[model samples]
Target: MYPKMLEVAKSEGNKEAERSFHHANEVEKIHAQLYQKLLDNPGASRETYAYYVCPVCGYTSEKEPPDSCPVCGTKGKMFKKMD
Candidate 1:
């Protein structure tokens, strides 16, 4: 629905709504990929893997977080780790 919302926002000339919907759509795509990876590796061990999440934008990473969030430009140091 974000894509559809994006289209609606575009048609209405709502710049802020368009930006929000576009960002949400892109982030959701990344989340879907991460969830698919988890499904594909059901037997994977947590001892060797972890998730790092950006506090600002909810960007999640299977490894170390990047120096900047791909979604919202949050700093890597602001990311919290989980296992």
Candidate 2:
């Protein structure tokens, strides 16, 4: 949705496009706040964990990785989402 909003801004440069971009950003901020709130809740912390997947070998992990994959030795950039 954010990319589509940016495309709208690029295709039609006007006040409306700028407004749409700000609105989209605002929505994203709200969503982040909601997620943070959920994570901050007492019982929810144990239920939630960071998730990642190696694109090269389809290995999934419960945390975001850096530099390399622990399972199949893939690079960090090759990681995708398992969520």
Best by lDDT: 1
Candidate 2 lDDT over 1-83, as tens digits, reads: 77776877777776677665665575456557656867788686567676675665445555575578654578987777654
RMSD of each predicted structure: 1.8, 10.6
What lDDT does each candidate get? 0.83, 0.64
Model 2 residue 76 distance off true place after TM-score fit, in angstroms: 45
Clashes of 2: 0
Worst 10 residues of 2 by lDDT: 56-65
Clashes of 1: 0
What is the lDDT, from 0 to 100, of the residue 27 in candidate 2? 45
Query: What TM-score against the true fold does each predicted structure earn?
Result: 0.84, 0.36
| Decoy 2 TM-score against native | 0.36
Question: What TM-score, to 2 decimals, does candidate 1 have?
Answer: 0.84
Candidate 1 per-residue C-alpha lDDT over 1-83 given as tens digits, one digit per residue, 9 for 90 to 100 = 67777888899999998887777777888999987876888876444777899887688887798898989999988999986
- Rate residue 13 of model 1 by lDDT: 99
Minimal lDDT window, size 10, model 1: 42-51
